[model samples]
Target: MPTIIMTKWPVKLDGSVRSKAMAFLQKLSHDDTTPGLHVEPIGGSADDRVRTGRVDQFWRAVMFRLDGNNERHYVIHGVWPHDDAITVARSVSLTVNPINGLPQIEAASPSVASAGATAPAPSALSSESAPAAISPAGSEPAAPSTPAQPAPPSEASPAPAPSEPLLVRLGRTRTELTDRLGLSADIADHALSAPNQDAITELAARHEGWIGMALIGLAVGESIESIVESLELDQPHPSSGSQEADLLEALRRPAARAQFSFIEDQEELRQVIDHGDFGAWRVFLHPMQRRYVEKSYSGPFRLSGGAGTGKTVVLVHRARALARRNPQARIVLTTFTTNLAGALRDGLAQLDARVPQVTGLGDEGIYVAGVDALASAVIRAAGADVGDAVRAVLGEDRSQPNGRTTSAGWREVLDGASTSLPPEIAHESFLAAEYALVVLPNRVTSEAGYRRVRRPGRGLALDRAKRDAVWSLIAAYRAQNRVEGTLDFAEAAAVAAAWLETAGSLADHVLVDEGQDLSPAHWQLLRAVVGDGPDDLFIAEDSHQRIYGPRTVLSRYGIKVVGRSQRLTLNYRTTAQNLRYAMSILEGADYVDLEEQPESTGYRSARSGPAPTIVPADSLSAELDEVAKQVGNWVSAGTEPSSIAVLAGDRFHCERLARGLAERGVAAAHVEREQPPKDRVAVMTMHRAKGTEFAKVVLADTGATSAERDRLESLDGSARADTELRRRSLTYVAATRARDELAVIQREGRRA
Candidate 1:
């Protein structure tokens, strides 16, 4: 069957024209010869290689038909009016750049000598000989007349000369761009021509391929190696097939996928039409992210990056990829919370609704749920076999242990434990960490096991006597929890892991998002659910976004990711201004990742915007009023109400902000676990907004953080440090969620 590579450039079209274009794509994908498509050759193009298909009476979709031995591939350039479509065809340049051997498709201004119009007649394979003038990178118009073809892309600017938005300060030589970095001569010259960093960013924004990614990555100080690994340009494809077939293969390259969407079948074409242009464009994956999604690891692989770095995006795509590759594989896609899992499920559906989804674990297809949900599923799957684990948490009765998630349960148990021991050994917080990090994860049921357990990442150490004391308290907590019918999420995971280890469950692959927040029991459960093997565990974590738990070492639970880790440093969700402010929140904190490696949260953003605004209002009440006005202004300026948010420190504060906005007649909804409705401004705590983002954020200080900080200050040693780390991370998480704008509301000297 013939393939269709839809150009994903920013095309603007009216509802009518867009509808017609969708119909044209559907018709073309099913049968190019369909009468209404009018897949006729365009005039003044060499060999009649470029053609125009009828989108409607006035608009036409221009494309290039590449013929293989037994197949044909049609690449739709854009939709334009007849006269404009003809000119646009003349402006189209599809070539495999000689430097990298990767296919390139772009549209130039009609005034510019388009390579397609001037090059040799035609080739069945690569458009390698075509050489369009390359200009310094810059942004371009979204579309033409009537939600039209993207305005002749700015990539078609004047030929590279002294370079605008120049990158002279970076001192990147042509050899580095070409031989070393794999950029085409034209693209290298374009980067060299730029006058400043913004030019590089502008060019990158317009190109949608290596040139844009490379320049922006370099502009933001990413190493050439880092950029190359993420782009996956280093992978060599030995060319043995017919030139035309090779061209098709080239589109499958990691680099080309960043720009083109190859429609697999009619259903995908339907999805393309339904998503329209921008929505489909949103699903494009960063090359490195795609790399993680597709690569097979010996055991567990970890992908780490700062907030908004697309870790979750990678996990979602990986789930689909793994499912497609292993049809019968039992794959579990999980995260720390049920809401995040729901978000992942929705994202997967949006990505490709065709991917199979199953409700329970071990069945074919994918099982999506929170980590605890996964644990519960494992427990439920091995119902009778899971009695031992149930007993571990529920004591003798082995009945359902249901109460608060053990946070309150731990306090209750601590309130009744012997108080004669040292504060560190007797504290509820200490016991919680010890149980989660050392005891629960290790399945330490007795004092001997607790004493022997290796607490690698724990900030404090316990002697034999201290261990005995802690074990006694843990015994009491479990006994009390069994009476109260209460079980912690971590305890459930521990029990589930133990059951899986003994019974050997059926999960083949597990993809975890927000891997850092998962407790020790969760890690052990994941390890057992999918015992270490080829492509077993794929975790996406950002320690800088570790808003909940302390640092975890995956090695302890046999979920090692030491040598199999990839770090993404580019922030895709925020502007440089917001990212900088977010990183500043973790200035002095050094984070050791799950592998015990010192991790840096330093990241560079592709886009630049206004520096984060600090709204140091006189008081919390005034702050709320100012925030309402700012959100009102943003909504008035055309930002979606849901895209505008006022993030507070807690639920109480979030509700207060929502009421404050409502009183001011700015519609706001306080969201907890559910998604914020599109018609209302999202008033949410910073914690609830962790996996989500906003276009404009008012990070209000209701003075909620001060009390926690004051309480943590009284904590000694590692407790104080861990609490402070999470506090900063929470603030960072909130600040970074702002894609374009961040306004901080502070009444005193503290971060909101």
Candidate 2:
């Protein structure tokens, strides 16, 4: 069997041509010299290295037969028409540079000279040289640089007229660039010898994180100091002793091979060639992301980063990697919400279609589901009814106002408890906080245990009498719930945890995503389902994006992640300006991970975009009017309304905005766990905005009024602090969802 490398050209070919190329490659992989393919060499090319093979009457594939030392491999460059294929084979040059020991491709045509001089040799500048001026098989080199000569006054700030149609030649020898900048020889050679600066510039622009390295400065016209700074940040103090070895290693790196791939598995090759998705998983991943997916862990591992940092990407790949490594391993991948779980499941199908589907938890190749859903399944599998718990906690009908239940609704339970307490006792908010943050998390089964525990972060000190009084109220509520056969979500998780302790582990590996938003009981349940061993558990979370559930400490739940953790810094989704605006919303708020580690202070994005628009109107109608106008303008400008999300502070506002938009003749649909129709505008609350993103976001009236703030301030100190923190976090999460543009619409003079 011979090694077959696939370049990006086939992916760009017409569908019929691509199919032909894939079929031809499949045959060539089994036998290098497959008969009837009519592989013929071009006579004019140096060394006759390039060859053309017949795909059919109309299509032809161009390939480079690399033969050196004992190694022989074939690189399929492209598929095109017969004439185009032959022309490409004749004009292209393929060679393995002895200095770097990596294969190089270039056009045989002369370099497009800048100013007066010709470009230098490959050995003169960088290790990786740019290919020649000959265009790709079916394409043509961009119309020559031809610096703008002059322009009429109608154009503002048009390109400056070149003094003599060209300035001093931009080209330099690899040796000259390397000696002057003190950079590695390979990098220098690549800058000086490459013929297509435009191609390199485009790559740099697309992958900003790799701008400083990869000889990006040469293409983007950056100074040496700036390139050095970027390289330093990418890999501070690169310490390889052998430049040639470093270049070889770099060639094999995941980041370097992101744009090209050599397929070894015939099945995987078929998937890519059939779908033309060459950049899918296994290729095109950032080096850091690949590390998170493949690194071996001694215990549980956690990958934390902000939204769009590829945390979920890592989780999906890790699960597939585990399943592939251990064919019989029972792997479970879960997230906090059902929406994200669905997205993960879809991603898995694309990543590795061969992964077998299990019936449910405890019976599978890989299980993908929401944590709550998994808990319910686990409880049912144990012959325990989870609905009984829910009915017991809420009424038999779960009759709560607005068809909802929340910790804030605990005021009703506090009312029952407050009757027995002194007049000086804090309001229902404080008691609710005491129950949720401290009492339930610690699982205090007795009055004595509750009284002995020190209340951390709780400002109101309680005497023995006060503590007993609070306990009596809690006991009463629990007794009613028990008699009613009801269990709240939190209690259901707790019950699941208790059952798991007695039932033993459910799977070999349990992966948790969006872990920061899970409740304490949820964590406890997760802890119980996986044994303490290598790869027992994996978590992907970001505290800053935590929008729901109580803040939990993993150590208390026996899920320690102190030593096994990685933080991803590069953000692939949100633009730099949008990220900064999102960060501003979280300003002054401190967030810590489950292990109590402060977040990375250096968190930043390299992708830059326009600053968010902040609109302030004097009245509610005025604000809505502005929002509608902006939304209409965006739609007129060719932005898909589905790609634009209009989020409000609460559900009521969301409904109001939707109605207003409809009245104005704009089609709007309320967004939920499931997505809205493609043609309709999406309207949702900030809380519902979790685990989602949009290309454009319109945050209409997110801030509360002075009266609302006053009411919040009236709550107990602990309740007020927690409420405010969660609110701020919600806004931050919403703001960060905008990838390209953000607009914050609010009533003028309203208190935030």
Candidate 3:
């Protein structure tokens, strides 16, 4: 049976007592018959501050373990007052046995034992220090009392042998250590499992001052064990065929798997860095970086801003992010026009190279295409029947006028709808059917009712109930023709939606740029394509530049405008004075508010710098000469000749302006219902300037009066509407063309 030991020592003793204790331990270790002793300091000064105050003062207690033949030693740990008298008394109670070489448990004094046997225990003693005693059997007498002297070297014991396994120590405090490192357990585990011994040593060294490192070393050992278990090996000496088979199996389980996993983790870390997680440490990033990350994770989002507000910049970032998130999937990027599409691709390429540190995005990553391109691709992919249907429809409508079709045309087509309708009527009916298919609620209906249903804003204006009935008939017609591969743009969207609804799947996400320019028909198509999935959808647009037309269906299409829905209001392209003058001309009474003008160096208008000159020319030739002289002054000032445009109020005026300017060596080309000019001064109608800008705009026919004015004013409903459209068109053109200067020359006799 193992024997037990107990000891007590004064905490306030001088350096002599410490020397005595050390000597006793040293003697015991050197003694042949004694086993090793382990001395562990239980709780020491917690920090440098505590250590300073307690350095001179002795500790109140010490616990030590000893081993001997058929005997074992265990220290009974205790806490007591720092008083010298009490500590001395407690130390006197300590005893040691020569035979077992262990400290015997201290016993109660005779007075206390007799008092306890005769009467109830005193409450004061019980509350202060509970009297503890040990069995008298096999116990040794106390050391003889003597004048205090330095402890003898013969009393000390040898140092204890190392016993605890490293792995066990690590397992005990894994959570505590990992928490301090600000790391997840999985990551910590991976780090600890580093294959190289040097790496393991360095990791262990990082925790040198920590008590937890003792356990961490063991964890490292466990990681090594796991790694070893994962490795596969074959028999040392196998037959020729067996050896060949083993070699083949080894090749199938190449070591690259571990290497690849590590590389992937490293790449994810790089992603975090590019996402501006490390921006706080850096000075700057390309403008697209912030826009990209914000729009990518901003959930289903919408953006609205003025022109030059970086809406397109944000769109490029979103496309890059989407491509990164779905590398293997085809990403479709669509814009309203071919020019815009080309510009977007160029912008994306520049962004990739400029911000190459951003992960998962490359030059070839995004597939930038236009809406027409996407539709054509989808139609072709649907099969030969769909292709033939599209071609036949296009061929039949060869003579159809360009631009948005009129409501009157829609009425006639709906009135004469049959299987053998004209190609133009068929095209109109197809769009109408598609709109009904997507926007109408699902239901059944009769043929008579279907014919009565007219498209929105068409037919004789009717009361609420009659209009509702028309809508119902439209819905019924749509329900009857819900066939796949039979939809035009609107119907295609509805069909895609139907596939999602019935077939139960959708693309990972959808992204739309320049969303504000999308028409009601285009929006219907987008809704059908997106369906009801959690796939991320990012939409960006500038409402002020909705130059496509004035119909908005964004809200009805399920995209929610969020955040401020505006960019920083400051304009970077134009001087504050120029912006103020431009806004004054363009804004009028509809202006809600204007951004405060920023201080700026005055803008230098191109040579012949005159505030817009409004000359009333007596003849077209006279006006052409004045315009040519102004153009000549700009050209002499180093402005490119192509930077100038001569805008007229009507197509006929544009033709005459072109011919007159040509006579003056201006080389003006009319931008009417014709292909764009290659290298000549643009003589465009004011309406055609809706999405264009020019450095110097000459309003040739601004002096319109009488019948010409009446004819021009009759095209739109209200005078205010026509004025606002023309003003916005001018603003768009002027703002875009003039990076540095703007000139607007009005033909004086062309009445406003």
Candidate 4:
């Protein structure tokens, strides 16, 4: 029996059409090659081979053939009205580009080309090739359309002269091209140096989805580097085995599968045929993501990618795999914030609802919670009373006069120290960094230890006198916290790490998502929880999306990832235009990996959307009005209010905007890294917006107050530059959270 590949069309059908389609699919699943099934041929270009089967008198299912290793595979492209399905079957043409090995599509009929007729509405298959119409068996296809000639480059607009051949011009060998383009070596080499150019061209047409587009772009004078940067290829691994088998397997890739649906077993196929839709995430692993999930590491392993690259997805899957493989294993899924941990728990639940060991802050199986929450839990298990310490800083109960919230106390310290700072130091920022990077992680309790400790990544230098003053400032703050019986996050994390070393391990494996936001103390605690052995740690991180926490290398904290690291370059979320806008904000800046390696490049998105809008207003009030109007527009366009977010630079504006929008009848809620309520627009500070996403985002304020800018400027040397970069990165994070649309609204009037 032949294998059957189902496209995404069944879900698009309804009423009579859907019922008929299901009946036809059931019959095909029973016997795909049965003569009575009536898989009639539709003549077209060889690369666009197709066939049709009747769903009913008015509708037909169009499909293509892929020769698999064990048997032939029939891929159902779509079920359409008889005429539309047949027209698509006969007119479609497919091809792959030689350079990138991605697919492209075009109409094969001369009349359609001459008439400039648009293709039918998009289906999963239409995303790959043109729709074709049925032609009688043995009837010849219509004459191929003539290719359009390019207009000559004018005096003002010039194109580069074709020279040195495309392959020679790229100056990369097969291996370099394969690695850079994220293609298999065979596909990259074949596209560049295939013995028969026509054979390569023919292959391009049959696999025109992502694979064909790359080859076609190369054929049309596009540069390999540019092509590599423009398209998102979820799995760029090279193809192997026979050409037919390789091409067939490529079509089954997670990226291509994302467009169409595919089912392997007959029972599942029947259920899908009967129900018309199967959950999309069950088998949906982009090639890169599959590798990340399935590969085994001998020790600590990390996966990094840009926002929406599915790092968290990999962690969820990996957690499930570990849980299922070892019944005795205890696993923990963690992230920097509670909201992200909640999202992770929800994701893991979807993957395996019966995993038996799912709990928050538990000791065994799979536990999902924030890192700090886990640390506090571990501390409590060790017989420590952590409520007062944790509550003084994080608790929302502000009714008591003696409450010493971390934020309020930190601000007070900054204000008191600012008046007495030496010229070389930015007192507030410098003291905070010293505490986090020096005192907390290193467990430096005395002045001598603080003076001897090395400060890496801190750009500013401090003399002995300055260091003494910083230590005194830190001591003063610690004394205040001690008096209040309150512990800051770092102090708590430090204590948690030490307690874990003595209290014994908490789990067999620890999987961290949003790993980039974790501080050094957090990593130390995570390291102490699991044995240093196989599968001990699996983390997904992206420094480009680091919106909070100090930057620290994992290796420095004993979590080494020297040879066990992967970088995902393709972004599966956010359209190309929105991604480009986000990239432009971080352009020219440098970042490092977990081990301090230079950042990798070639980040690209496979999808496209409208360019981000920047709305300028005469004043702050006008900016708020524009933001509110934009939110209303998105709602009018049918987006859920919960899918929209409005972010600002500080809490005051974030809260004010949420209130302003609520007054305008837009159900808006101010959420700060807490579980966002459904059906209401979320408004939060940029810091709180980290590790979260929305369909549409409105950045309420972009203009920095003159006083704020002046204060930053007063900082000495690169410290000022670092602050600005962090601000820009925060904006970038907010902008990229928008999967479809982004609008930046800011005031423009001069300061008094």
Model 1 TM-score on a 0 to 1 scale:
0.87
Candidate 2 per-residue lDDT over residues 230-271, each given as its tens digit: 333233124356443333344454544433456757887776
Per-residue lDDT of model 4, residues 578-612, tens digit only: 77777777878877767888766566554444557
Kindly list the per-residue Cα lDDT of model 1 for residues 1-752, writing each as its tens digit: 56888755344565566767888888887788878778888666643568888887878887888897587889776666667667767766676655566677644642422321122222221212111110111000011111111112222123444433445666668887888766656767777787655556655655555666777777776777877766766644677656667677777777777666688888888876775553253346667766777888998899888876777777777888988897988899888988778878877776688889898678899889998787777767776666776656434544563333545766787777665667755777777888887777666676776777788757777777777877888888877766666567887787888778788867899899998898878888888888768999998888877887767888877877778898877666676767777777788887778887888866777765656766567766888788987777777766667667788888987888888889999999999877677789888888888767666788886344566666665565788778777878888888877766777777665544
lDDT of each: 0.71, 0.63, 0.38, 0.64
Q: What is the C-alpha RMSD of each candidate to the true structure, in Å?
A: 7.3, 9.4, 32.5, 9.8
State the displacement of the C-alpha of residue 485, model 4, in Å, after optimal TM-score superposition.
2.8
Error of 4 at 153 (Å): 25
Off by over 4 Å in 1: 14-16, 46-48, 81-83, 106-166, 174-190, 193-196, 222-246, 277-283, 391-397, 401-406, 416-418, 422-425, 447-454, 461-472, 702-705, 749-752
Q: Over the full model, what C-alpha lDDT does candidate 2 score relative to the true structure?
A: 0.63
Candidates 2 and 3, the one with greater lDDT: 2
Worst window of 10 by summed lDDT in candidate 3: 133-142
The clash tally of candidate 3 reads: 22
Residue 292 lDDT (model 2)? 74
Residue 1 CA error for candidate 2 (Å)? Answer: 6.9
